[model samples]
Target: MNEDERNKNRMSNKVVNYVGFIDAPLNAKDLYPYNSKVGGSPVWMAQPPAKYSHIKCTECSGDMAFLMQLYAPLDHLPQFERSYYLFVCHKCNATRQGWKLIKSMERPRQGYNEYEEEEEEYDEDEEEEEEVQEKVVQNDTKNENGDDDDDWGVEDGDDWGLSGKTDNNNNNNNIDELLMKRDKMLKEEQAKKKEQKNNKQSTSTSSTSTTNTSSTETSPLEGFVTPSDPSNQYKECYVTIEEEVIKQQKMHGGGKGGKHGYVDDHSEMEEWSGESYEYVKDRAFSKFIKRINHYPEQVIRYGFGGEPLCMSQAGNQMFDVKTAYACKRCGKNKVFEFQVVSTIITQISHNKDVSSLDFSNLFALTCPNHCYDVGSDVHNDVIYVEELLLVEKSI
Candidate 1:
């Protein structure tokens, strides 16, 4: 027998030990009775129960003390294409992904026919055709596997399967690295585009300035009513400076738990009448409360209710308020009301061209909540706005 045949023979008779499977050897019909083809191949039974100690989980270093099976016929080389086993801890099957060994099966060698082997011309054509077909199949498999390389990278690492589990911190690190790599690549691409844009702008500017220098001096601002107009021989042109109008754009509040610089106080705005106006006011307050919950600051004071009330848009801060209330079991009735004191909204921008600037709007308010006991006097508590709602504006 040649090497291939020798390997096949050894595998057929081999009795390698494994971790999980049936122990007894059953006939093909017994194991897969309903299968169309039984062929005479033997099917092995599952192995008996066994204990695994110091079974360190691949992800965690904790010991596993579950009973599992010992599989037999570890090498499925001759008749079978691959071998498989289960290293499952009965309690935690979520961490267990079965192990599979994809070993190559021995191919049967064609016998040498002296008389037929004389047709070498025909054999060459057949061999070439087979080689071309195998090449095509290999190329197809490679193309399919190459798609979405990022996702497949996780499977390539050593500590992935149940036998070699990864810890939470290591997994987090891997994720962070992947994100950082992606961000770095994106930044590099953006920088390249920006550099190209700057180069183009510089080239355009040089060409325009060169052309202007070659021609007669002509003021580009000739059409505008400039302050330097020579025909200004009349009434003093008082500069009618327009008061800046701030148009606010919606902003999502920051995350929870941080130092907040502002508090929510809307007591002054409460004086507005009518049901329709009151509804709008309440809506605004609700939106403000939602925004505050997202702030990163830990020291934010909302109204007297423990609910998170407001958020500071600019920095590390959130404000929440907790009101003092009698227990629900108490018979006396109590009422709580909140009021706003002073209010201010401001917009500031650094850009010279009004249309091109990135500007922000801020809203500041001072509010107080008054609690009245059914038969007693009123008690007042103040919630101050320390953080400004620095919101970006358009136009």
Candidate 2:
């Protein structure tokens, strides 16, 4: 069999168009510190957003548990260091994001890469963990008899996935040598020059968001403990994404697939189909099932700014986003970033009562403007912005 055939899982449906599918679920602590992961407490980017230090459930006024963290730094908003943190309230399930969607964004530290020095310490262990993670994903391709679940990643000859910021912490070698390598990678270029902006730009006074006044406190979770609530917590797993391959697909209306995927005059159809919004919802609900049937195990779809595989017709679609879901910090319109599928709850915990977290999909809309900036103490401060997120329930 060719390499593509070799890597194929038992499922026949092939993932194409460079979409990121999370794989190799492992304990969050086993992998690199800066990588994407599900469950467990968050690995804070800089300092924890103080206001969120104690998030009470909107449903029951109880504490929330950490659900997952996605390391999705946008290229468009490269100056800011970014990561998405999800939390869930255990007291009441199906609260539809009554828990929270917190986004940590701040300018890069003025000195060296924030994670480089720390990550280097665990180079040997991290490399070994990655090997184990790969093996776990491979084993998932088939049953004991080795049949079924066949096409999980790029088909044909291509077989690599581009994880947006998975490799942010450049590892190994002399400290100086590692930093030198970062300058060469296109992805890390923005991070390198981010902290060089010494001259402070005038702050926006028109619509200033004072909720996240910059703080320099060390992460609160470092030594603190919360009331023991086992049901709210979940097992940890590192999320590794593989690229979906480009392929040909005959489009409706006598159209053809693009270089990446099929396209059409889909300005409106892309958002929703059918005449009435309710009918559009029915069409979307049907598609959701059919789509998940092929790759039901996908915990997340990570393609910031790219289209989110819809789980509903009204999933944050029926709104003037600027007015309804403006960025709490920048006051700019939030755009679709990535999404967490309900399948994640299956992998989140086996012991915990995850019943309260019911949803078909959780669509995260983030501020593409990325207007948050580090305070004078860039080395010590952090900016945590509350982003927009919505959950789609079963139709």
Best by TM-score: 2
- Deviation from truth (RMSD, Å), model 1: 40.3
Alpha carbon lDDT of each predicted model: 0.28, 0.54
Which has the greatest lDDT? 2
Q: Write the per-residue lDDT of candidate 2 for residues 120-220, one digit (tens) a residue.
A: 63574456556645543453433233333323332221232332322212111222332344334423443444433222212332123353456333322
Candidate 1 lDDT at 3 equals 28
- What's the TM-score of each model vs. the native? 0.19, 0.56
lDDT of 1 by residue, 147-265 (tens): 21234244534434423544455554555564566557556765675687579669966887897887544222111111222212212111111111223434456657443434333
How does candidate 2 score on lDDT? 0.54
Each candidate: RMSD? 40.3, 20.1
